[model samples]
Target: MPEFSRLEPHVVAEILRICETMLDEFDQSYKHSFRLTDVHGFGDFDSAQQLAADYRRKAAGTPESARERMQQFIDALTQLRD
Candidate 1:
């Protein structure tokens, strides 16, 4: 069974919302990073993608990044409740 199957409907909705919001934010940030690289003449598509891939690898192994993501979810939930 899925973990969300055990969760209340509203809680599940909030979780999904949080995930969508985070993904949107990540997309925006990614675009901004590329824009910055272009503006500074520092990176190209291959380099940018490589950097992102490297970060993904690092983040996957980093507990701190996981905590940061959890904190982002908690903060979004708090904002929604307030």
Candidate 2:
């Protein structure tokens, strides 16, 4: 891992902010998925299965996406600082 301690406070703050936004978006997506599942039918196994699949997609996809994004931001900021 990069020595984050060497990074500027503002850079650290921005990283934190980006992470917070990603978390918020993930939470919203999860809630929306649950709501959609409920709307289709509370006891519908198929709907629940679909939701599970979607969640799996999200879970599998989001971290790498977020990491790339954060790295891009870090690279850009580091370049600017340099």
The C-alpha TM-scores of every prediction are: 0.40, 0.39
Model 1, residue pairs in steric clash: none
- Please give, for residues 6-59, the per-residue lDDT of candidate 1 as tens digits: 768999788878767776665555444433322233367888778776665444
Query: lDDT for model 1, on a 0 to 1 scale?
Result: 0.57
Looking at model 1, report the run of 10 residues with the lowest lDDT sum. Answer: 33-42
Q: Residue 4 error for model 1, in Å?
A: 8.7
> What TM-score, to 2 decimals, does candidate 2 have?
0.39
Counted clashes in each candidate structure = 0, 0
Query: Distance (Å) between predicted and true CA of 70, model 1?
Result: 16
Best by lDDT: 1
RMSD of 2: 9.6
Candidate 2: Cα lDDT at 58: 47
